[model samples]
Target: MTTGTPPPTAPKRSRARTFVPLAIAAWAVLEIWLLTLVADVAGGFTVLLLLLGGIVLGAVVTKAAGRRAFRNLTETLQQMPGRPGATAAPAAPAGGSKGNGFLMLAGLLLIIPGMISDVAGLLLLVPPVRAVLGRYTQRSLDRRMRSAAPGSFSDVFQQARMHRPDGKVVQGEVIRETDPQQGPSRNENPRPPLTP
Candidate 1:
């Protein structure tokens, strides 16, 4: 944590980062050209048919691939060891989910009224792209955590312990009873004393 200078914003591997999006964009440009030509020469109904076909194609491909993608992400996160009793390891500070979410959002940007969105969505869906994104996000988080104020981690740990899943504090004090004889004996059927 430097006092004045900000941490590096650039990713460790820029080439890797650029490749997925660029490839997707290229593919999308081709699709757009072909689709537009078909629409122009074949007319609107043909274009609509192609669009539906494209959607089904994408869905089938993604369905076949998406489970493995989720598993990889989940395994990576699960392998990350947090301090004892913490539910989730403080993810690489950019938050891994945030990057994945951003990629998903990029889908919207790439889609509306242009082929760019389709390309963008494809890039985002690609596991390689997400992996790079997660790596960089983790790096960013590491730097930020190093620079955070002292006691922040401990404070967070304590807070996590206090709150249950539904937001209630599960903490309670224990009290010991001293009388052993008054306690029920194992397997006993002692009669209750008669009322005085």
Candidate 2:
């Protein structure tokens, strides 16, 4: 009689870690090839015009999105709790709700010298396309969040602090004395102050 044993389970790796870089590299190669083909068909001057036009359009789009996001932030802050006329409805994130991020991403893609990217960017600029893409992205993110282990998400932004010589977490702000005239110099504070 032989005893049965379970197979060792390997740690699961995120697809994004491997897939994103590979996809980006492949896209870069294909984009360069496509640009070369376009340049060959259309004169070099035409290609230059197209590239410049795309850059300018992208810049304008990006700037508009930035301004809109900033305005949204200001409005949200003004309406946040503890302020006047604070509503029961939760405030949507500045860029997240209105597809501002997608707009910015489209601008970035258009700014990049590539036909496929430019086409995609132009598509994203359209309201209907942006809405569809935003929904898809949100669903994917929600799915990922549901699958992720509890507390893992918070770990990504966890703060770190080195313990002092006394081996305790100090609750205080650190003030740097860059200008000698401002406060005590390094020599004066050789022994760090432990004022609670």
Candidate 3:
């Protein structure tokens, strides 16, 4: 990858780049290592029970969070301000809805079959931990927004007039006669292609 800037030119198109397999391999290795250590002391069946319990609990948590989010949304809509010249409705309180997204993420992590994931998910379920995480996330986003330039999107290829395959399209100015074929339709004023 070239780091330094080159002379000004059109921007490059974004290319897809993902590390899904690499991430899965690393996560599986760590999880297996941790599970083996736990199993050596607690026995294999106990490990199985823990993993199964985590799945069940994750599902319950996910369902509860969904319901809570829906309820909060309905309440907010009900509290929407009335039409013209009236006092505005009070906005939802600060840190309101209490990070329904984080709760759902916690549930998802717990659903993943790994001890490390379960621990992380459990931590996210705590209110104090969620608050700290929320503040940190907000600050990081604010810093990113402040540092980055919001340049306009590139307009390359926008001037193009995309065409259809139908033969009915006409691409010339109208003549003020009943029929132009009766007179000279010169080569200098040749009609443009019906499709461009």
| Highest lDDT model number | 2
Cα RMSDs, all models: 16.9, 12.0, 11.9
14 in model 1: Cα distance from truth in Å? 29
lDDT (Cα atoms) of all candidates against the true structure? 0.61, 0.82, 0.78
How many residue pairs clash in each candidate at the backbone level?
A: 3, 0, 0
Give lDDT tens digits, candidate 1, residues 86-190: 455444533333344545444444334344445666677667787788789889988987777767985575567666545554455444444687786566655
**Least accurate stretch of 10 residues (summed lDDT) in model 3?**
152-161
Error of 3 at 127 (Å): 1.2
Model 2 agreement with the true structure over 28-53: per-residue lDDT tens digits: 99988988898899978888899999
Tell me which residue pairs clash in candidate 3. none
Candidates in order, TM-scores: namely 0.34, 0.64, 0.62
- The Cα error of candidate 2 at residue 14, in Å, is 6.4
Ranking by lDDT: 2, 3, 1
Query: Candidate 1 local accuracy as lDDT?
Result: 0.61
